[model samples]
Target: MIKVFYIEDNNGQYISADGSKRWTRLTGQALYDFLQTERGKKTHFFVDTDDNGVAIGVEIRNTELASNLKGDKNHSDYLKQVRDESGYITVSFDYFETEDGTSTGDEVIPNDEDSIENDVLRQFDLETLRRALDTLTEDEHALICALFLQDKPMTEREYAKSIGVPRTTLEHRKKLVLQKLIKFF
Candidate 1:
């Protein structure tokens, strides 16, 4: 009753578990905690067991698993000692589950089309932008909108006169609004 779980690497190949001739014995509670902590980090996990339903070793899915496993060699070695003391030669793992599930491997990195579009749009999120505009006092919103719509960029003084706000107040509001909008981008 042993189950093995693993995932293929970016290269479309799974690292062979067979090369590591080590057995780490863990109690059911310990295994559950390990699975919970390692779940999102790796692709999968599995339990190895005997025909009599006796628990054996466990297999982890990715390089993250290996890194976590090797974090403290002394602890792992102790677990191996425990397994040997209990009489299992080496850990068993499921191979079929490790088959590559991704159609596109690391040979090709997908282009960031959305990022390119965002760069072109600059600080634009229709809803958030609109809400940010709405939050502005009417005069401030009108002034900012006018400046944005204009083909040319205007200085704070020019914008202040156009919006009819004092130069200092206009500059302050502009800074605050711009700061809020920056998060959208």
Candidate 2:
């Protein structure tokens, strides 16, 4: 069975259902509401679906806003251009298939050692890494230099005080920096 769940921005109402036919109508309404909210904005949605083409749930985003939040100008600019020219954007759902057509019923976890090694290898690309580092604000650079470069991973509170940014802001900046750095791998 496919399950569908969505929230309508206009009225802050949520709708959910199981089975293909029952969910179809709600899905249409949700899409219409999504488009309405996305007027003059670029958007994307992540849909979780079952093997039988039934959607399990959906998560939506303003693509431009998300890119800006990540401090990623390239993506934000592209999405902005697309939104300016197009009234609506179509999104495709991704489906993951099981080898034996059965749910594993277990969480997929990464090997920690391998992940660490990969992260280290990704840091070895000097030019790209330097460029990513350059994108950071001065305060962000100082904090990162103190942590990874200088071998000190300060707590969020300590890092924020040292960098002269709010703890939350510093946390967000660190996440964005790490995401950009990961692309080099």
Off by over 4 Å in 2: 1-128
Identify the leading candidate in terms of lDDT.
Answer: 2
Query: For residues 33-128, could you state the per-residue lDDT of candidate 2 as single tens digits?
Result: 655765413444444446787874434456665445445546665786898799765333223336765644333445888899988777777667
Pairs in steric clash, model 1: 2-49
lDDT to native, each model: 0.59, 0.61
